[model samples]
Target chain A: MLEKSLKGNLGYWAWVLFLLGIIGVGVICYIVQYNYGLGATGMSRDVTWGIYISQFTFLVGVAAGGLMLVLPYYLHHYKDFARITILGEFMAIASVAMCMLFIMADLGQPMRALNVVLHPTPNSMLFYDMIVLSGYLFLNVVCGWVVLHSEYKGIKYPNWVKPFIYISIPWAVSIHTVTAFLYCGLPGRHFWLTAILAPRFLASAFAAGPCLLMVIALIMKRTTKFDIGRVAQDKLVTIIGYAALLNFFFLGCEIFVAYYSTIPGHMHTLDYLYFGLADHATGQVYNNLVPFMLSSVVMGFAGIGLIFVSRYLKSDPLLALSCLLIFVSFWIDKGLGLVLGGFVPNGLEQITEYVPTFVELGITAGVWATGFFIITVLYKIAISVKLENEKTA
Target chain B: MDSSRRKFLKIAGITAVAGIGAPSALNMLMKQEVQASSAGDGHGAQPAAHGGEGGHGAAPVGKRYGMVIDAVKFHENPGMAEKCIEACHSYYNVPDFGNKKDEIKWLWQVPFTNAFPGDESHYKKDDRTHAMQFMVLCNHCDNPPCVRACPTKATFKNADGMVMMDFHRCIGCRFCMAACPYGARSFNWRDPRGSKDGVPFIKKVNPEFPTRMRGVVEKCSFCDLRVKRGLIPLCVEATGDSKAMVFGDLNDPNSEISQVLKARFTIQRKPSLGTMPSVFYII
Candidate 1:
């Protein structure tokens, strides 16, 4: 089964090599960052967290998004999803791996990361985040491997795998919820203090995660004999469509609460993100994220609208385009906008804009490449097993 | 085959439980031992005797330390805040990164509005009040968000009500930085002891205090080292006038800080957030 990844065409090897090249670049950049400290990145005292944290946050949702498929297929016995559940689990394994890497990259002392476990403070949300994420990663690895191995052996999956699959359903929700608690529980961070933050994270994650899987499924359909049946793909799109709507609705609720309350504390971060927050004394407006945030809102609606339309959903190219749009939209909202927006008009009401350095971008790209590499190999193996099973039958 | 699998599961379960349970049990034991030793040293036993007397020997424990800043007095005495900041930085060997981005500050000043953002009063009639700068530092809150956020107890609230940081244990996640409402903590973005163009970041080294390494969050430990040596914080010492900056036990009602709070109307920054800041400003 492991040898399945080793057997690939020229194109497959080329793609693998491309991912490896990006990873190599990332390793070099990380080495420089390791020596120079986080000072090598553009993050400052004001924006203590930047690209690394934002990516970690976004990827957590992508990882948890696997729950959408797992829950429906496993719990409801949705037969249409049976073919693609392995894909969701494998993607989750890869996404969780990236989330962990992003967290490590963000740490100022990467080596001391084990301290979180050694001297675990249950009170800290990060402590729980570490537990859930690693636990989810472990669950996905065990469940995916056991099920796939059993499938390769042409037998029913072991009964022991049932309880693990059942636990993973709720565990998925906990990972994102704990990640949200990391921000929402903090005092004086007006942007993330809202009660709906966890729900918002879940909604965006559901939308973005499945949308990404849909796009990947479409790509696999073109590239390989693996077709995650049209019915399953359409159902996934329906899930993504509703989740995107809910995500936007939550965003609207946040905006309404911020504006209707007329509290400067609640409204100031939003103002800075959408409409530049003006310094009353200096008459200087900080609106670095205004363009990105506004575009996110536009892309989110446009993407959701395209997917919801029956005509576009029927068209593969258009559906793929819509998914890419929604995925990018959520990426901006969660990956770029949310974290940066929270920090702007910082605790002292002074705005310091964050722009990631080339080194930061290189390292981020490296992490993404690593995730792709993992999924590429995992998917290749899954597809090979499926094809082999189909021929045998 | 079934028996072998069940046996493997049994061994794995024991290993897993031991792996997680051992450290936690040891941590609890270590905490109790520390408490027992401190209690034996009389630091935790007799709280009433060590109240504002600036007790000799080990710093007074089982006390809530607090600071009261006389804002009006600070305003009257120009350059007082600057001197205090200088004293704190020099004493602690806090590096000058030569730029605000990487700057490390234990104590600093911000404009009146910035210091007390909750005060939303518009159109200040007096230019003096408008232009006033308030000294700000770690609040060392009774409900410290940083302590609650630190995954490793690297930053913990001492029995004396001072928030202390163990630089060695800090994983540099910056969760404490995001958690701190006051923006009190600063991450060592670069090695504090390192040099640039043949010039050391810390011009004068303070042998008494350990300079921190790169990638650790640090802030005012309320001069924990100085306090342990039975001396007041450097900022309070720099002020020279006892009325300008008061430091004493909040638990002892007879203490100067407690007396100041009783006599004057003092405000803590972002009191609405309910951090219960130990530092108070007399407006």
Candidate 2:
């Protein structure tokens, strides 16, 4: 199975070479930043967090996608998902790996990260997030490798792996929950202070992650001999449909809480994001997020609408388009709106917009390329095993 | 159903429930342990309370130090503002990036509009003449959100109620910056010992206090060092005779800060948020 990744066709080699190219450029940029200091990036006193932290948040949710398959299979004993559970677990491993890399990139002194362990502070939400994320990563590596190895060998999975599989179900939820706690518990950031933040994070993660799983499954169907079957595909569509609705419902709840409460703290971030700040209407200042957030909202609603239409939903192109919309919508929401919303009209009520430098974008692309590369190699192994099983059948 | 089946169900059910409750429960217990350990005078591992040791501490023990500012005095005598800022920045070695976008500040003045926002009727006589600029610093909050947010106990409150920073321990996550209600914390975007054009950025490093590295958060120390030596905060001393800034113990009735708080109409920033900022403005 491991050899399968090495002996891929020319197209696979090309993909691996492409990802390697990104890593090369990113390493050069990282060296410049490491020597010059954080001043090399566009981050300042006001907008401390930038695209790095934003991507970290989004990927944590992406990593949580594994549970969609795990929950259905184990908790409900839904045999349909049993075939694809390994796919979700493998994706979790890649996504979590990316999540860790993004956090390391965001750190000012990445070397000093050991201080979190040397002097632990449990009260800090980050302490908990780090613990859970690392723990979850370990769980997935053990569970995913063992399960996949057993399948490739055409043998029953060892009984010892059961506890890890079960532990990962709840551990998956904890990782995302702790990630939300990182934002929501902050005092001054009105955008993320809501108690519903964890639920909202989980909901969006469910939609985006499984939607990704569906994309992967669809790709495998086309490119390889492995398919998850029509029944599982329909089940995933249903999962995406309901999860998208729940994600939007939770978002609506956030809007209602912010508007009805009339606390300027709560309303400010949303107002700045969705509707352009009227204060900026002096025509002097501009809230650039307005257009991006508006597009996200429109696409989000459209994605949800398309998911409900049975005729359109049944079509592969339509479903893929719908998932693409949902993916882009949440990606922008978490990336630009949620992360930057907390910073604009910053703690001092001063408007300081953050614009990332080219160097920052290069580093971000490198991180994404690394993630995609991991996903490709892992899926290659997964599909080869699936093909072998099919041949045996 | 065999005995093994019933035993498996019992163990699995308990494990599920414990796993769900463990994180929050562990968090609560850790918080209690932390609070219990750092009970009196937030910093220091002196097993006993203040009276047990360090009894001859120059700054009064068991007292939260606070400051009251006469906005009018500083507004009228503008030189006092410069002197005060120079005194604090020089003492702390806070970098002067010479650009507003990259500005690093410890104590600085903000216009009344930005400082005490949403209060339209702040100035009765004239906006320009009456309390135009207000000085702001770390609150040394009663419930310091920054302290809670710091994963390392790098930034902590001392027994004297001054917020302290352990530069070596901070991982530079900037979580404290997000948690603070007032924009008090600043990260070293560039090295404070900056190298400029093949020359040393800092020609003469302040030897009295050690300079910090590029990857840590720093803020107003409330002049804890001077207070330990029984001297007033440098800002208060530098303002000279006019006494633009008054620093004293809030707990002692005889202390100047307490007396000023009782006598004048003073206001702290964002008191409604319950951060209990120790810096107050005397209108």
Query: Largest DockQ belongs to which candidate?
Result: 1
Among these predictions, the greatest TM-score belongs to: 1
Off by over 4 Å in 2: A278-283, A310-313, B1-61, B118-131, B195-204
Candidate 1's residue-wise lDDT over A1-393, tens digit each?
999999998989999999999999999999999999999999999999999999999999999999999989999999999988999999999999999999999999999998887787888999899889999998999899989989999999999999999999999999999999999998999999999999999999999999899999999899898888878978988899999999999999999999999998999999988999998568898888889989998999999888867434478888888899999999999999899889877788878889999999999999999999999999999989988998898
A108 in model 2: Cα distance from truth in Å? Answer: 1.0
Q: iRMS values in order, in angstroms?
A: 1.1, 3.9
Model 2, residue A9: displacement in angstroms? 1.1
Question: lDDT per residue, candidate 2, B1-283, as tens digits?
Answer: 4999979997997898678557656766787687777665567453322321222232344777888889888988877888898888887777777666567888887776557654546645575634478888888876678887888788877776677899988888888988887888899877879766756545467889888888788999988988989999999998888878899888799987787789888887877666667788875
Compared with the true structure, all predictions reach lDDT values of 0.90, 0.81
Assign candidate 1 its CAPRI class: medium
Q: Which candidate should be chosen as best, given lDDT against the real structure?
A: 1
**Tens-place lDDT digits, model 1, residues B166-254:** 99999999999999999999999989999999999999999988999999999998987777778999999999964789998887889
**Residue A182, model 2, lDDT:** 89
Give lDDT for model 2.
0.81
Query: TM-scores, in order shown?
Result: 0.94, 0.89
Q: Which regions in candidate 1 have their CA more than 4 angstroms from the true location?
A: A310-313, B1-21, B24-26, B29-61, B122-125
